[model samples]
Target: MAGHSKWANIQHRKGRQDEKRGKVWTRIIREITVAARQGGADVTANPRLRLAIDKAKAANMPADRIKYNVDKASGNLEGVNYEEIRYEGYGIGGAAIIVDTMTDNRVRTVAEVRHAFSKYGGNLGTEGSVAFQFKHCGQLVFAPGTSEDKVMEVALESGAEDVVSDDDGAIEVITSPTDFEAVKNALEAAGLVADMAEVTMRAENTIAIAGEDALRMQKLLDVIEDLDDVQNVYHNAELAE
Candidate 1:
């Protein structure tokens, strides 16, 4: 697997416990609220809300808490209003980075984000600066030991766009964002469970960074991710393992 994938796996595992748990919940709650506000409280009729609910369930969030947020956002109760924002930037070695946020305070969010970039050896860029380097899609990755042939067969038959096996034996299935839930359900019905699956901004290409540059880039990413308003951080940097 590429170092970026490895790093993502590490973060995924680590995010479930300790201080990161609360941060994870905060981000998920924001997502659920936004999804509900945009669509509706009914998961079956709202794909975005359904995805957010799935993430909440995976994180072991209480059903009542999840419902409360949805109800509040759907106007059953008063709630804070938030706006979605996307910030593009450059990391170590000029690698492209994109930060997604939902905030009630745009000025505060922007300042904190800009400070994080400048403090971490990165430069904040204008809109569309680095977003062109990514494709919005749904991706599912299976471990090295998984059966690639079976995955390919099932995925392609179930509305998947592509199936690719990396050098490290990881199999990735790509799908349109709209087809993500359907494809995922089909895979589960076929007894295939992914190690990682999500709708994301997938990088089209990567910048390889090593040694000191890699360390700095990791630090930059960490700071950006730690920001309260930052919901998701995507980058095109492949760090040295």
Candidate 2:
């Protein structure tokens, strides 16, 4: 994490997401289906499902499509059953990578993921091989030029675990997953809007990857992310901008 720029990283991620907009609905549907199947169809009672629905709305997905997927997954209608899987690996410069997938065919998912890593000179590691490098939590990032003092005061007072403010990086508020919504709501009420927020596998530290290694690393990440079953990818590479 020594040379990692959180703001640049977040912006880069958003740009990548825009390029993958064609597949956004597919991924959200899978997320919605799995969440509902595992935790009933009631969004009010199922936090996971609620978050999935929120993502769908953010993506401008139709309400009926979202509801149908929920009903289908909850057994009110027929649907494919999905199983969650996590794949750990190492990218360029020994940077740790973690992939989260929901799939009906584990064999196919694993093959595709492994092939991507091998193609890019990386290797798929054992489960937990790289998981220890990340912390599972919620993060809210405010853009630069925002008042850091106000953000710190409101975030910490509203259950955020920590607030990291820096001129060269994102003003990040970290929280326990359960405390995430409360802290976000508090920030909003205080007129502090986060540019990005999510529950994620945040890297504890990062490795600098520049020049050719950075290009290879980005290509590797893009390939893995474009896989049909992959929902999210986390890594510790601080790539050159």
Q: Please give each candidate's TM-score.
A: 0.94, 0.95
lDDT of 2 by residue, 36-119 (tens): 988999888898898889888878899999999999999999989889999999998899999999999999999999999999
After TM-score superposition, the amount by which residue 91's alpha carbon in candidate 1 deviates from its true location, in angstroms, is 0.2
* Candidate lDDT values, in order: 0.89, 0.89
How good is model 1 by TM-score? Answer: 0.94
Task: State residue 143's C-alpha deviation in candidate 2, in Å.
Answer: 0.9
lDDT by residue (tens digit), candidate 1, 1-241: 2323443443444553345888999999999999999998988899999999999998899999999999999999999999999999999999999999999999999999999999989999999999999999999888888998899899999999988776667788889999999999999999999877899998888788999998899889989999999999998887775
Extract clashing residue pairs from model 2: 1-206
Worst 10 residues of 2 by lDDT: 1-10
RMSD (CA, angstroms), candidate 2: 1.7
Error of 2 at 49 (Å): 1.3
